[model samples]
Structures are given as C-alpha cells and as structure tokens.
Target: MKKQFFCAAAAALAMISAAPAQAQPQTQDDPYQWLENIEGEKALDWVRAQNARSQEALEADPRFAPMYEEALSVLTSKARLALGSIHNGYVYNFWQDDEHVRGVWRRASVESYRAGAPEWETLVDVDALAEEEDRNWVWGGVDCLSPDYTHCMVELSDGGSDAAFWREFDSSDKAFVEGGFYIPEGKSSVAWLGPDTLLVGADTGEGSLTTSGYPRTVRRLARDAALDEAPVLYEGEETDVAVAAAVEQDNGGAHVFVVRSPSFFESEYYYARSEDDALGDLEKLPLPMNADFEGVLGGRAIFLLREEWTYDGETYESGAVIAYGLAGAEAQTVMTPAANQSVEDVEIGKSGLVISYLEDVSGKAARFTPRKKGGWKRKEIGLPDNGVIEIISAGGGTDDAMLSFESLTRPEALYYAPARGKLKKIAETPAFYDATGVVVEQRFATSADGTKVPYFIMGLDSVLKQGNAPTVQYGYGGFLIPILPVYYEDPARPQHGALAGLMWVKRGGVLVLSNIRGGGEYGPKWHQAALKENRQRAFDDFIAISEDLIETGVTSPEKLGAIGRSNGGLLMGAMLTQRPDLYAAIDCGVPLFDMKRYNKLLAGASWMGEYGDPDIPEEWAYISKYSPYQNLKAGEPYPKVLFYTSTKDDRVHPGHARKAAAKMDGLGYDFFYYENIEGGHGGTANQDQLAYRTALEYAYFARMLMPRSE
Candidate 1:
C-alpha cells in the first residue's frame, strides 16, 4: 500500500532547459555531446537510423518472430488476473489488453470481485477518450474522496510521461465533471479535501516552481476558482525538492498533512486543522526528518524511521515503526524487526495496522493492534513460506482487507482476510507455464568485503546437475529497492520472474536474482553500507555473484547474460567496463551512463543522495572509477551490448544511452541500440510494445548465450 501523506522528491518536472555547456567539464571533451539535445532533429535522425539498423539485425534472427509471438500471448492473455484496490464498496481497477491499448478505468463491487466473475463497469475508456481528444493519454491513477467516493481526480499522462494532467471525474455519472477541478499537464500532486475543495501542488507558472522544476508551493483551491487565485497554504524554498498536501480520512476524522521534502530522503510534516486553515500556522509533527509518515490510524500518526532516534531518553532503532497521538506528545513503538528481518511496507487497516516485512529475503506479514492502555500486540498472518506477500487493499472505512501471495514456481493467490475472520483464498491465477521439474534454491556469494550476498536460482533440477546451461541474471543494487520473486509477466507486478520462467527456464536455462549490498534486503544498514564512497561495494557484490555462478558450474562466462535497467542499468555499465569478459551479453535499458553530467539531467539532481555529486572532485574520484562512459576503452574486447531506452523518458535522459552507444561505435566496437519513440522510463507504452521489447531482450540472450549447431 502506498503511503497517503508523502511527497516524492523526484516528482517529474515540467519542461526542462538544457544545462549550459559550461556547467559540465566533459561537455567540451566529449564529441557526442550533441546527443544530449533530447528532442533535437539531428539527434532524432541519428536515433531513427540506429533504430532501423538494429531492428533489422535483431528481427532477422530466426528466434525473433517466435519469441515475439510467445511474449505477446503471455502479455495479452485474458487468463491473467485483474488486480484492484477496494475503494468504498467497489474494487477499482485499470486494465489494458490487445483491444484496449490505452486501457480502461473500471470497477466492480467487492463481493463480485471476490467471486471471480465480476460484472465490471467501465467508468472511463481511455482508448476512446484518447482518440476523441487526439492525445495518447495514459492512465496514471484516480484519487477519490473517502466514504462516498463519487468524485475523483483522474490523472492522465501524454505518452506515458510522469508529468500528467488531472481532471475531475464523476464516477456516479461515468464522465468527467463539467467545470470541476482540473489541472493542466505538469508533474502535480492533488488530494481531495471535500467534494468542492482540493489541496494541490503543481506548476503554476514562473516563480511558482522550484529550481528542480517541481512545485514548491502547495495551495488550497475552490471548485470554480482559477489556479492563480487559489490561496497559498504553505510555501517551501526553491532549493527543496518538492512540497505536497494530503488528507487521510478515518473513522476518527479527516487528518490533513503538509509534507515538505528537502531532499530525496528527508521530509518535514505539518498538520492542518481544516481544509481552509492557514498552513503557515499549522502544527509541525514531532518526527524525524528522515522518517516516513505511513498514515493516521486510531487517532495516531504512524511513522517509519530510517534512522535511530533518541527521544526523551528512549532510543528507537532505525527501521522501527512507531505511533504517536495527534493531540498528545507521548509515543509508543508499534513494532521492530529482528536482525534477520526488515520492514518492507506498512498498511493502515480500519481496525489495526498491517506490516509487511522481509525475513531473510522472504516475505512475512502481521497485524498490529494498539492496546487499550499502551504498546501494541502483533498477530502473524498465516501465509505460505518462501513467497512474496503484498497488501492489496486496506483501510477502506472497514476492517476487511485483501492480500496477494506468490513465489517463483507457485501461482498467485489472493486471500480475503476480514477483521474478525480466518484468511480465505478468494481468487487464484492459472499457471502460465509448466513447472514440473523446476526447483528454486537460495544461495549466497561472498563479496570483496566478505559480506554474504544472497541470491535466488530457479531451473530444472536435472539441467542444473548437467552444468554449463545458458543463464541470465538480473539485479537492481541501488535505491534501497529489494528484488523479490514473483510472476514477472503480470503488468500489475512487472518485477516478478514469471516471464523468465516461461520464456527461458522451460527452454532449459537458469534464472538468477541477486540481492546485492545497496538494496533494502536487510534494511537500512544493508543499503547504507554501499552509499556514496562505498558505492563500489554494490558493483563488487554483483561481480561476486557472477563469479559464484561460474564457480558452481552453473554456467561459463560464454553462456552467462546480464540484465538491468535504470540504476541497474548503471550496474550493467559498470559490469561492461570493469569486467566485460564475465558475461556474453549485457542489456542496459533506460540507464544513467554519463555520471559526470547526470546531475544536470532530468531528475538527476534529486538522486545525489544515492549517487554522489560528480561535480565535486572528491566525489568524482570514486564515481569516475565506475562511470561506464568514462571508462570505456577503444580496444577492450567488450561484449556486444544491446542498449535500449525511451525517447519520451523524462526521468533518465535518453541521451545517456544514445551517447554511450555513439562513443562505443567511435571506438570501433559493435553494439545494438533501440529507442522507443513513445513510452516513458518504462521503455514501452502498452502490452504489445512491452512484449516486443521483452522478445528482443530474450532473443539477444539466446543469440549470445545458447550453444550453436556447428
């Protein structure tokens, strides 16, 4: 469950001006800096040329067409479950397939949804709306008012960009409310205060945004008032990352909050008495700046701490969940994980709080109810071991909640856990592929620093014993994000490994998921161990896993392939330059390659806390060691890597991939490059595009790693 009161520091910005050439020391030295012009005609022409050349090469492979068809079937199959959240008495869901390319916002009653044959009501057909408006509108989400849930703010993005336009929609009438609350296209945050009032943070014109290009001022606006006429509730510094407002409705009452994010990981929260109350005089919550505000439950403000806090001689350890009364100063610890556990998520329920945590990289969930006197009691939810459990719905003005569970070889099952009843399975997804001989094992690799890095390996038992099977490994060792095992093809849960199971494992291949140091596998300390100067630890951990695989005779360097994206793409870059001979293929997608100028790129500055500032020489000394573009040599005999990115990706600039490929080309190296004309950071807009991209990746792996018929 997403937190109701929080502002994202890396919220997408409006139109960004290119950083001056003088700002980057490498700009003058790099010959392909012209690729930095994201929408430049010359740059786009180069992109198109590269796309055509690579598409022809990859598509010509005999395996391409079959793999594409298989991927499309898996992606568009109606057998896939439609996941949703419970709002009011309805289960709201957004679905897309071959027919509804853009998708549709629909809903059904909770009873019907649980029974499997839901009589779904299409509230909005995004494809029809997009065609009528002549805009490639992508559904972001809908923020609805609590209790009745009749009115909502529907977020629509053009070309799947993070920056979106919002319009008020009336679910009762199944149409956009005429003259209702509407916000023009920009990265904005809005929450419902009432049917006729809103708390918004968005691009309001010049001087209304921060230097990072996000809204620094949060305002309260009336239904028919112009944006400029809205009353300023709170204003933050331009140097801050962003500011936003949120309102949480519970049985106790509605709680309004103003969140100010100064950096990527720090935030200040203020509470307002009412929607029309002046936030300038709002009471500041007594919480750690690095703590995350989970939600308000039982008249208490719940917080998850990122760092240890000693308040009133009471020391609360880092990663502990605590609660404090909104009107009282006293606080109580709700729950704390053991050494082998880390809190992954916190969900507020109508009667209690549900905590989802990772125990030794496996998922565990429990319910915590506050005691009448003080403290809290925990009741472990009876869930299957060795599976990932996620809270699907909670705190919808009722004690009823839903949870979903799945594992690498197991199909997903949704359980309905009422406030006062036993957990019962309500729906189950049919297996997409056979797992007759498949087995999963948890193994650990010793890093350079002697840290045991855990990883999951899935394959046929007989195939593993034979040794030297073609293998592909995936890792995302940054941003405190943990990669768990699940059904990967489900668009709702893209991180799962199910696609690899169906496409590769069934074909006699091994799949590996590495839980390296810079992730939140074991909590804050595990991630902090690889911060800034120690960032190389993450790279070392990944390399250790690759070596461990070879040492175990699972696969040789000639049969090993590596895949990563975004920060993981950065990892792929490091892998390519630091140890190109370790793997046969590297698929770097929507990556951050040019560390020297990443800070000046889109949303790059917001991540300085994760990756140190490259502008500073002291920090550059360490960053340059792994900066792929800087480390690429003319005659390194590097593996022919396939680089893919999205032209509309407003988060990580597409230039990172374009320039990296160009530099490699100039160095007399062979590589493949493809940039989607649409999509965003995800690199694909809909199922068809996703299927094609997945097929391309798998085909590349097969071409490079599989044994040839000589």
Candidate 2:
C-alpha cells in the first residue's frame, strides 16, 4: 500500500517534469513566503482586505442590481422553508439570509401543520457560536449528534500542527456543555461514550507523540468529571484498529463495534456492551463483507462491497437488512443511485423504516419496505427530482414523518408524509424565498465518447435563448459526492456576473449542472468509467456538455463560465489546462492542483484509492497527462482563472491552491488568487463568513463572464 502511494506521487512528479519549459517571466516575490512567515492577526488582516476589495468591486457593478433584487426576493420568500430532522425533535435548517441574525440555527416542532408557519425557535446564535468559541472546533469536518441528542462534540486546535478539543455544546439548552480540558496541542478527535462519556485520542505536547504516537488510548470520562480519573477503556494494539462504525444497539444499551483494518478493501468487526463484564473480549463476527462500509441503518449494518473479480467494477451495499434479527441474513438490495444521485437518508421508525434511495431509474427518491421474502419491496415516492429529500423522524411515536424539500428555482417546501401516504405542506426552509418566477428541469447531453450525461438546468422561465447570453456550468465528479439542487437564490451565481446570474436569468442567462463521470449521477458505473487512468473521461464529458449549450444556441463559449470546488476544482483545473478555449472564466476553489504532492500533503494521502498513485510508474503516465498543475503551459491564451483557498484548510492543504497560483503567475497565465485564514476545508468557518466568500466568487464570475448590456 505504501509503495503504491509513493508510486502515484512519483507518477505525478514525472508528469510535472515531462512538461516542456515555459519562458520564465520577470521574477516576483515568492507567493508561498507568506504561508511560512505570516502569523495570526497579519494573516487574517490580509484575508479581510482582499474580501473588502472584492465586495466593493461587485457591489459597484451596474449589472449587479437586478440580480441582487431577484436574489433578495428568493432569499426572503416565505414559500421556501422546511423542518429538517437533525436529531429527533431538534431539527436542522438554514433560515432566510435576510433574517436579523443573517442565518439562524433553529429547532422546530415535528407536528407543525401549516407550511411556512413560525414553529422553529433559534438554537444557537451563529455569531455568538463563532465569537464565544474557536471556529475550527465548531466548524471542522463533520459533526455527529449523540444517541440521546443531549450534547455535541467539537474538534479544535491550539495553533500547533495537530488538533484537539476546545469546547462542547449542550443540545438541550443550546449552550456550551463545558467540562474544560486544555488537551495537548496536537490531540484530536473527541468521541463521546454517552452524553457525558468523553473519549479523546491523539498525540500530545507541541509535537511529541502521545506515548507511542497516534491516539493509542480511548480514555473514558470519569464520574468525578476530572481528566485524571478518565481511565483508558482500550489502548495499545487495540487503538490501532479503525472503528469503521459504532452504534447504540442491543436496545440502545450495548455499543456494537465494527472495527476495520486501514485498507479500503476489508472489514473485520467485533461488538461489546459498555457495561459488559468482559469489555475487552471483542469477538469477531462472521460476515462476508468488504472494507468499504456505510453506517448502520435501522439497527442493521448497511454497506457496499465488490467481488474480487476484475469484471465486477462496482460498489454494492448489503443494504439496510444486513444486521436485522432473522431478516439480516436474507439480504435486501437497496438501490444505489447513479454516481451523481445522492444517497437518500434512511429514517428509522418502529412502525417500519423509510429508506429513501437516491437517483433510482430517475433522479427522484424511492421508498422501500423490508419484505418477508429476502429483499426489500421498492416503491417510487414522486418528489421533485431537482431537489433533495431530508427525512424527519417523529421519534417512532407518530405515524407521520416530516420532509424538507428544495430546488434551485422552487425554493424550499416543508411537507409531512404520513406512513405510506401523500406529502402535505408544513413550512418552507427559508420561509421567505420567493418562487413566483422560478423554473427547473433535468437535461441530458451526449459526451465525446457517445455516453449520455445528465444535468440539471435552472433559470427564469421568462428568459429567452440567446447565443450571447451568459451561462454558468457546475460539476464535481469525484468521491461520489452528488451535486444536489442548491436553493440559494444568490444574485452572484456565475451566469449573471458574481451576482449577475440571478439578475441575468431574469433578463436571460442559464445555469447548467453537468452530471459527468466521477459523480454518482448514474451510479457506481458512471464513476468507475472515469476512475484512475480514465479520469479525463469526466473532463471530456463536461466539455461535451458545454458544446451542447453552444450547439443549441443557449450560450456560446465567449459568454460561458464554469465553477467547481475541491475535486470539482480538480475538474475545472483540468478543463482550464486541457480545454481553456471552451470557457471565458473559471472559479477553482480549494482544489487539489498538485496531484504529485497531494498524498504527501494534508488528507491527500487517503484519497489514493480514488486517484491512482502518482508514484506508480504505470499510473503516473496517465495521471500526469491530465494533472492540471503539471499540464499548465506558457504563452497560451488561457481563460481568466480565480484560485481560492483557506490558510486554515487542514484537509486539502492551502499550498495546493497557493502553489498553483504561483505557477500560473510564473508562467504569465491570466489568473487571480484569494486565501482565507479561517474555515477549515471550507473557505470560512461561519455562515456569514461563507456568504462573504460566496459573494466574492460570484462577483469574480460576474465581472469576467456576464456580458455587458451597455
């Protein structure tokens, strides 16, 4: 595995060196210098200045007005809102941007009757959440709600190389659930045993390894609430095991431990109760499964694995019936939607479970019931395909389940689906997002390889097709992360000018979402078609989609633009380097540009299973061929490119974006760079901070791609 990793990196490096040299331009200060020298206040100050300037330019653009008005209308409309389930009765939702708090995190009543009714009350003032605690702890990676939903865990760092716990939130009162422990600077991952049972694992001190490096012990939160009394539940060789999943099973008493080896292709599990007298005896379970596993669903282990046969080339889950009492072994084949279709969330209830499978046959969600004869009985739930479904559990008491649905043009509609019945309106998500002038539809385009690619297009119905009309195309074809409909009515969408698209669509502009390979638009097959050496297929598919727009007279290359973040950034990067002639503007944010050094960098090492090892001689030949950073050339008429990242982005190192920008500058490519000092993977940690960055991106797109009416 290690050898394969470095081989991929080597391949990437070879690709970089293989490129012909460009005529070096006049030397400028090394952009990477700030990365090494800049400290706290100074780094943040730089981010603020750049944002201020970008905002000023965007707000000043004359074309920004109408888009802003439309954006504001959709953002504040009452017809767009929903009550989504996050933890039992405590829901999760993003209210209107025009709210007094910018955006409120509120909890709502699951049985509220009228849609758009004021049933939710604020939980945490986001502004206060950011100010009172460090952003990294509160806004990093993903957060999990406790089984009881009484407390929330936050991962934090103290400026050392690694991360540690900074704070905890009391979910009941929506306040800080404080036990105060200044974990060593490098310590990370604070898992809760129960509501008050805390388990911290990591190295300690500024850089010193914790005893034997890595988090070797799972410490228990003591009865006295003191750090010293926190005894080690499991440590040493046992800690090396990767806990793929842990659930409160055995009647919400015993915790089942499905531990796994580090390999992406295997799974070895064992379960034990917290109160078990022999807690150390973790007996292995007899199950034919792979390392690629999903979390437990309906008290059953749900996961996808492939056969050893090379012909398999697919990821198939064992489904929700995997671990059920007598029904588990029978096995049910739950639908794995197209690679681009998201996995519909599974809601567990006592009456029966509602498993919403995404992108099955169509983009819409499908429902399933565990059958007496092995597999599940499937039924299509006719919800809009353009939007996503968020299932709200009624805590197993009520027969009715609430749904939060939204799309780009439709806003958000909160509905209640009572046990195998029709959907009734409850409330909109935004409670103020206007849908009076909205339209959305799914479109298909033929790829360069004759493959039919799917896409979701959104715009105002009043707009007419014009050749010169601006268009913004979006895509992300990696990790099977579906690009579901975004109900954000921001005026700063690409087609309109950062804020130009929202307003431009009202006049005439289009938003096209390319359902290319590397995404689950069709399912595992769609993604596998573009895996490893075939990565370029996704880019080719995207290019073909863009050409389709031009052929149909919807928009031309001169007025066309593109946007993608992270893996999608990688796509746009390849597009800019491989087909710069096809786009007028591009927004590449937090991208993995330097494929060669990606593994060595933060979190990049883990994704080798997706993108072949750069170190591998064979894989390098193909990977380097399309690697955006290494493939860049000089004296070429490259499209205007904007590269964005965050200094605190501990995942895909900011260096990826920084180094790419530096290379672009040295090669004299028409490019711009912006770096945020906070917000881990995301450019910002706070919603308002995110809004500011979003506005900046839209503004840049508007400035470069939005055609001037004058």
Candidate 3:
C-alpha cells in the first residue's frame, strides 16, 4: 500500500525493461537478474565494489567529516525531547544514543516526567542483551500487559528488519522471563490478551506466509504451549494482505478482534471473546469494508469513515468520525472534517477522543466526548497553530496525552495535555542548527492538469534573493503520509529536513518540501487522485514546484539537487529518466525502479491495491510509460545520481537499486552507488550509521550543486 508492487506477462514494455537488466549473468532476458540473489556471494561482491567507490568519492570531500560529526552530535544530544507513552502510572520511553546503540526500554513516573526532570529507570537494555546473545538485535517494540503494566512482550528484529521474534519480559525484575512466550521471526503480530494468554499471527514453516509474505491466519497461544499447537482463531485467504488479532483496552474492558485485510485500505473486523482458555466464534462487525476501526472507548467501537455509510436510517459522509455501540444501538456522529481539512490522527483517551488534523496544511487538534443523549461534545485543545501537531500518546490507561508541535523554522516541543486545565510544556528539542534569519514560506505551483500544488521553501533571506542559489527539492508522493515541515520524522532517512537544514541551508543553500498528490496532504482523495494510471500526476506536481523555483529565480537547473527515498526514491527515478535536465544532482535511496518485476519481490504483491497489478496488459500500458528503469535514455545529460540501498533490507528488496545501478553502468552513465552491508529497509540501523549516511548524502549535493569557492 505504501513505499510501494505486481507480476505480469512479458510484453513490449517487458522488452524495453529487459534491455538494461542485461548484464554479465543475464538470465531469462534480465542481465542483472543475479543482483536479486540478495545474499549470494557474487551479488555481494558487486555491492561491496560499488560501496567502496562511492565512499571514496564522498568521504574524500572536505565537508563530509564535519557534517558527519554535526549530525551525530544532534542525533545523540541529551537536549532532544524524550517523548513518552503513558501506561498505568509510568511514562515510558525508548532511547538510543552513542552508548546504547541498540536502545533501552526505560520509564519514569508521570509526576517526574511532567515536572520536566525525569528520573529514568531502565527496564531492558537492548544493547546489553545483544552483546550477551552475540546477535545483531534491533529493538522492535514492547507492549506491557494492561491494568498491571508488569508482564510484557518484547519484539526484537535482526538488523532492524520488519520480521521480528517476540519474548516475554518482566518489567519489575528488568529481565526477560526464562523460557517464557517465545515466537520465532516472521512477518508477525503478537499481543498480550491476558497475563497467561497471547493472540498471535506468525510463520511456522509451510503455508504460514501469504502471497504477500505476511501471516495468513491468526492464532491464540497459551503461555505453556508451542506455537504450532496454538488454537487457530481465524484464517484468511493467501491472496489477502494479512490477518491479525487486535486488542483494544479502555476503562470498560478489553475489546478483542480479528481484522482481515484483503488490501491496504480495506479491512473486515470480527469481534471475539475468550473464556476458559478457549475462544468463541467471531462475530463479523456490520460495517463497510472501507471503514477503518479507530479504537474502543466507553463501550463504543469508533471508526474513521473512508467512504460514505448509512446505518439505521442515519447517513455519515466520507471522512466523518462515527461510533457504534458494542452492545448494539444506533450509531452517532463524532466529528466531520471540512472541505479544506483532513483528519491526520485520532487517539482514544480515558476521558475523550483527541483528533489532530490539517486545515489547508495548518495543524490543529480537538478533544471530543460523546453525549449521553445524542451527538458529541467538542473542545479544541489549545496549542500553537500553523505548525505540525503530532499526538504522541493518548489512551494508554490515562486521560493525559503527550503531543508535539514544530515547523520548518521552529524546533519541536513536547507538551502534556492533561485531562483538565491548560497544556503544560514538558520540554523542547534544542535547535540543531542556526535558524536566525531563516524564512519559511509556503507557495502554490500550477501543475500541468491545472491543479495547484503546495510546497514550502526554507532558507536564509539572502539565499532566497540570490539568483540561481544552490537548492534541494525533497519529496515523497506515494503512501498516505503527509510530509510535515519538521526537523525530521524517521531518523533513518536523510531526506528529512534536519540534516538538510544543518548541512545545506546554512551554507547559502535553499531547501524545498513539496506537498504533491499521491499523499494524504488533503486526505484520501489527494492520494487516490494519483493512484495507478494517474501516477503521472504526482510526478507532474513535483516537477511544477521545481519549475516554479527556477522561474521565480530562486534556483536554476544547474544549482538544483533532488532527494527522496523509498517511495520518494521512485519519484527520484521518475525525475531521473523523465526530466534529467531539470536538476544537477539526485540522491536516490532504496527505490523501486524495475516496476515490471516489483511484485514478484518481497512484500511487493501486497501493494497491488495502490499500484495496479502489472501482470494485466491494460495496467502495464500506463505503467510502462513512466517506469524509470525502462525510460532511461542513452544520452540526456542526466545528473550524476547517488544510488544507495541496504543488503539487509527485507521490505523493499535491495535488488531494485542493485539492478538499476547495473543498468546505468551498462549505459555508460556517470553515477555513484553505495550498498550498506547491514541495515534494513531504512538503510541504517543506528544514529552512527544514519550520521554517516547523512554526511555522504550532503557531501554529494555539495560536490554536484554547490558553486566553486573563491
């Protein structure tokens, strides 16, 4: 569904696509097909060779070492905000730094955390565990049992991959339970249903994985039983994306459910109950497939409507928040987003529901409580406007919630939105770079289809006025993710604004964050508009912004550098083959270039809902037009792109970048390629790795886009 995949017949587009794939060990018309052999010694040799060359090219630059150090300092800074999740009376936080590279599960009392001086207590040291076990263990997540908040399930992945193993841990003793609840690695989802019971979805060899490489069935595991002997709660088709059991707890009771997802945006919910160490038949919830189950509060099943639905003579529009009685009664409306607004996040609390939204790209939040008579009561939570609002924690056994606000020029600040009274400022992240004289401006660009695309430009006033200033355009147009103007979100990716501001803007460079289609900037409609065949609209939107910057004299083609990773990496590929003349440099990371073979790769088939099945001829026609690898030309003065991927990346297969680089080399094009031997889909596992990658990225831009020193 996101960061997107499909399989198909070999057609004329196949011929065009196969041309570049032809390299040394060409198999079945794909020359670089051997690259897909992930851990194969031969494939790794090529990756190592590329990494060496790229490291030599970037690390030798004078700006690289200093940029690396600065990034590491900010990443490991103690001044950064410690975001916490409320559970019982504790505020828990997961922290990773220079010392705890693998991170630590720690917590502090709610009182201490709110006082702005937290007394930390480490429950589990992941770094120490990894050292003791002699394994590359990454902290996946830890979910403690409700009510007591003592017994917990800890998930740990290898090299930060999606597949992870689960282990039972005792928080009070600060140690894992000896030989307690252990589920081996797979694309698994497991949770605590009770103190001695667990609801699980994982692999046990044959038929455990769906076509999408996820759990095809949900099972209930006892504390003493082997996973294979666990009772099957529900089973879904192999074609389905996944089937997993979910547990929603509140003041009323725990609401257990089995959600079967046929596609990314569609889910079928079945309510379940357990008694005497056994499960009762699941009762399918009478709700539209498109309705997303938000959470349960006050014995009501809350939902976010993605499409219109009429229940019991009452009609609710799409994007409306509604709730139905778990004991069976008429559904009631919660809140509806306006034409210009899009619901960004919804969190259920002990006292009310907290909804954060974007109105014309401005962030706001409101708390809602259902009335006993009919409708609902709404109270807007007072917070700074015109910035990014993230609901960090809401309904984890407490009415008090944790939230953060930030903007392009503003450092992120954490706040405690208590059950009553004003929002209290807990802490603020120190400025990563000098923001003095920096200006953040939003401008609209006209796309080819007459649609207005929004984008934010941040830079020093002098740089904004300077003609043909060195500029970097960053974007990710797929996935319903709205790329807010923040310092950074995922610390794993370099495209986020933090490193760009620290390494680029201060050196007289301009940075642009474009809000293009195929994203949830304006909600689901914005994303649907650019799905499948309409995918070109997303590319056009990004291009329009690039053109606007050039036409407005903020930057020219020679001084422009573009960066995007994952889905945005696909966008970079489009920019590469579609309009290479528009930029001077491209940093393409872990991208999907070979669209024809994408679905056959890991987890790619699951995204057929977003990107149509390429196996079908009609779908291939539109896709072949913009498929980046197939679109590459012999000579177009294309920018020297730096292609980077990770050998341990299990989500977006490393083959995508590997095959593309091999093709580029065969075409006699100038480029840089780097493949990290470790790391997962994020391309980096820890702050140290992220800092190094960040340095390599900014250094590449400096060499390609920056002007010569006097």
lDDT tens readout by residue for model 1, 1-710 = 23221111223333333343224444568899889877789999999999999989888878888878877777887777778888888998888878987899999998898787788999999999999999898877888998788989998888876778899999999999988899998878898887788999888877777665568898889889999879888999988767888788867467889888787667899986563433436788878887888888877888988888888779899989999788776788998888888898888877699889999999988999988877798899998899888887877777688888898888888888888888999888788788899999999999998999999999999989999989888888877778788764244223355677777888788999999988889888888888889999999999999999999999999999899888889999999999998999998989999998887877777677778889899999999999999999887969999999988877788889999999999999999999998887778888899888888888788788874461
- The candidate with the higher lDDT, 1 or 3, is 1
The lowest-lDDT stretch of 10 consecutive residues in candidate 2 is 11-20
lDDT (0 to 1) per candidate: 0.83, 0.55, 0.81
**Better by TM-score, candidate 2 or 1:** 1
| Predicted candidate 3 versus true structure: per-residue lDDT over 623-675, tens digit per residue | 88888878886878888899998877677778999988999988899789988
Report backbone clashes per prediction. Answer: 2, 55, 5
TM-score of each: 0.96, 0.78, 0.95
Cα deviation of 87 in candidate 1 (Å)? Answer: 1.4
Q: What is the C-alpha local distance difference test score of candidate 2?
A: 0.55
Q: What is residue 533's positional error in candidate 1, in angstroms?
A: 1.1
Full ranking by TM-score: 1, 3, 2
**Top candidate (lDDT):** 1
